[model samples]
Target chain A: MSVVRITTLSKSISNLFKSLVSPLALNSFFVLLITLNISAQDVDIAKGKSLYNANCASCHKLNKKLIGPALKGVSAKYDKEWLYAWIKNSAAMIKAGDEQAIAIYEEYNKVAMNAFPQLSNEDIDNILAYTDYVPEPVATSTTVSGAQSSTGEPSLANDIILGLLIVVLLVLVTMLYLVTKTLTSIAEKNGIKIDQPKSEPFSIWKAFIKNQFLIFSSVVLLLLSSAYFAYGYMMQIGVDQGYMPVQPIHYSHKIHSGANQIECQYCHSSARVSKHSGIPSLNVCMNCHENIAEYNGEEDLEKGYTKEFYTNEIKKLYKAVGWNEETQSYTGDTEPVKWVRIHNLPDFVYFNHAQHVSVAGVDCNKCHGPVEEMEILYQYSSLTMGWCIDCHRDSNVKVKDNEYYTKIHEELSKKYGVEELTIAQMGGLECGKCHY
Target chain B: MKKITFFSVMILMSFLTLSCFDQSKPNYQFFPNMYESVGYSTYQESDAFANGIEAQLPVDGTISRGWVPYDYPDTNEGYELAKKELLSPLEVNDENLSKGKELYNIYCAVCHGSKGDGQGILMKREKFLGIPSYADRDITEGSTYHVLMYGRNLMGSHASQVNAEERWQISQYVISLREKLIK
Candidate 1:
């Protein structure tokens, strides 16, 4: 029996050793092959990348369809000679009735590719090499995401500890209850009474009714509270301070303004010259969205704003804008994105955005709050008459370099006997300034 | 016992009142007629227009106030012709250059770096790629204006955001940036 066991054990050990060594040897061989392959094409790819970025990147992307077709593995699809001729002058080939050229021209809505007579055959070969080059994903990235989860482990631990505490407390309470029951039963068996306080029936309401001072005080307190509540209810009637309506599109101001650091006036261009800060038309969106088709930004997975979720939102934008991504052309079918307006002043009030934004040079954040930080935009202020007046009273008027305001500012400063003048002092409080 | 019940009821009432403030909906208006405009406000949905929207596009042939007609077409040949012939009406002055710089910082600097080195924030972030430096491209004032009027390649037309004067101002600034880069 001992001999048989020893033979089987040796066989199992050899099997385990072979299993380990075979995979290790194979992995090293593949790694060596990949590294050699990369080194061989590295120089060509480096040059090709710069050339491709300069000449081709404006219209073409590596994998995704842009204004032109995807350039990844493009060499496999067409002959090198044909690619060379087409790259130099695609229009000439289409005119010459080349079948492949014509097919491409027709496929891409007849948009002629820009002729690059500068690029030689070697340059073209390098570009193709660059297109074919795919970098292996680093193992460290998974470890980094793993590290992020480990950082989050503290909160998970805290939750578990709290749950354990609750369970412990529950157990202790039940045990205490059981102990008390047994003790009471033993007391009853031993003919010993725990408590026997004999008293007449009592009613809290009756006692409270008998107390005149308490009743009077309670009535006054009730009246005061009711009046306070009523005042609060009336004051907030038209406020809408935190109105955050769901927009047709989930356009995160946080992503655009905060993370991207885009200036407020980039989209709200009208704020510089007009009374209203007009909503940017769809073309403004197309300016960036045409190129940035995917969402590769940071995500709040807990909030369900995942990578896929943001990408879906981008798709919704494309759908509303009627852009055919495959053809890279407008379909002439668009539905309006009805963005819910958050800050709406009363009709009587005349709030000029240019006055605040351009003339006064007030920061957009001064009124709009930290709009960049807000994931879902809501009214930061009450937008009430009192709120406007309060700002006008406190904030100094910005007059420097403003030709329109210079004269008024000088006169107002002289009249007020101060170097600086508040907007309220400069006739901002005048009824006719806002209301006719 | 009665007092506890009474106090709980009051607490519940307060909670209900507080919870009634739904953020998704507008608050109760004192007078909606006073708050809302009688006249058609900008971007308002209405029955007056066939499209049922207040913000309508200008008629196909009609020109709004202060609009200068651009003669150049959007074709590549038009781009070449415009590059050679289009001249800036605005003189190269400090005021114009400064205004141009300001406008460029707002509109162009996001993609076309402030120094026109093609290292703008967007380019650095890799959102946009292969933006040529101002010095790299042999662009004149006219070509710049034409490109601004009708955007070439990946760029969209900025005409809607800026007026003709602003475009010329931006072009002047861009030329200045190119000169600085060349130096």
Candidate 2:
């Protein structure tokens, strides 16, 4: 139902062959190109795009200034002959001391542009024409820019449900009171003895208190409740398994790792070779945040976040990084984002990230839990010594061609007469292994 | 009046209990000594030094052990010189090249495309522009190492992120990528 433009086709066609290896394929591709090139009128934008992607896209874009100035409306800036000569060989023109060529080289801090010597004059013209060609803007996705999903306002639904329940309860109470009043009135009319309802409550309370069975049951109830609360309170101490603190930046691991599928090591890169799983520095955040300055997707307010909330959170990153969107440059007015640490272990215990991640080959989720699904990161594991001992007792060392584990693995396997050795056998459970 | 007072007190009691239930706050610690420790926490400042400097960096000009010195200075002349002279110490083996490719994908491929064609996701999405293809230019291992050591133009130095050997590995990978682009 959508239009498939030649530009998209050209992009795909070029992508089909990653790098031109076969001479036959190249010749046939060129022949196909020449046949497709026979469109006499429409300015050859598709061919130009193909040529541009092959020759120039790696370095230049239509609107943005990357390693060089933007190429949009570039044809208007230079005449045909000058453009052809420049495109054919800029180095020669620069050496010849051509003013324009030298100025362009000087403008971008002397970063040289590659020459397209093989491109014909017409080919260059087509490329210049494509530079002027504009693609139609696509409609914004329903997910990002549309009527928000129902979950966007969860509190309203909860409030309505609560209000309805309260109304129903009030109505039920009123009906019961009316029925009882009517029954009393009928009894009085019939000349029957209608005893006062007030005295009944006190008599019932007194009789219940006098019963030994009731007293024993009350004591049992009190004991059970005390034991329950006491056990719950005692168990909560020093075990912050679900401790999820509010961070300075609202960085959702779910959106990043779950939705985006970014590998954990991409951010926490030092996990593979360091003692500490180092928190990602601001530069790493800048890698993606520099571009993704706003959230466009529909955010669920049910999660206590609005669409604007996420966009504003991204603005917080910009403020910390000191990046100005207009100029697209850092202002050098930087501040460190103080992230709240969640998983804290006792000082006496020793743990090395590189040992587990690099050597043992333990998945990050084995300890960190399903971090990708965590919107707000929590201390998923107990991080207790018992938790550590249990894992070491059960898990085996990843000893496949691992030079670090070769000698130890050989000795342990041979001695134990087992193909695989659990970490405990490799002295993992030793008190000195952790406490020291 | 007594029933009204009792209901008000119950409501007040519930409100008080609700205030104590903060899910974001960590549970009460058992032993302060066992949890808190006698030592200062990471990144915490202490007033031991006269200037209140917490960083215990060695007195100026003393390099830590195992830190090899790079001869090139952070200048354009140094870049040009390194480009002309710098050679990778590591042999061009599959393992080194593979590692180099992996590192390149992590660091460089964000701005420099995976194929070293400069159309990385950032470039395609129009975040950063004008990244040159590896095939387009004449680059050597020295230049790559020097660039990694001291970033040129918009790119920043990656010396802190990657070590000397890793830089060489990345350089080797880039050279191979350049070869592919040239074809």
| Winner by TM-score | 1
What's model 2's overall lDDT? 0.79
Indicate the worst ten consecutive residues by lDDT in candidate 2 chain A: A143-152
Show where candidate 2 strays beyond 4 Å. Answer: A1-42, A46-67, A78-95, A101-107, A113-229, A288-311, A403-417, B1-21, B45-62, B73-80, B94-139, B151-156, B176-183
Off by over 4 Å in 1: A1-42, A78-123, A136-226, B47-50
lDDT of 1 by residue, A17-128 (tens): 9998999999999999998986675548889998998788888999889988999999999998999999999989999999999999888776788788889888888999
lDDT of 2 at B13: 75
Interface RMSD of 1: 1.6
Q: In model 2, how large is the Cα lDDT of residue A145?
A: 50
Provide TM-scores for the models: 0.84, 0.74
What C-alpha lDDT, on a 0 to 100 scale, does residue A77 get in candidate 2? 92
Per-residue lDDT tens digits of candidate 1, residues B121-173?
A: 98888788888889878899999999999998899999989999999999999
- TM-score of candidate 1 on Cα atoms, chains taken together: 0.84
Task: Please give the DockQ score of every candidate, comma-separated.
Answer: 0.68, 0.29
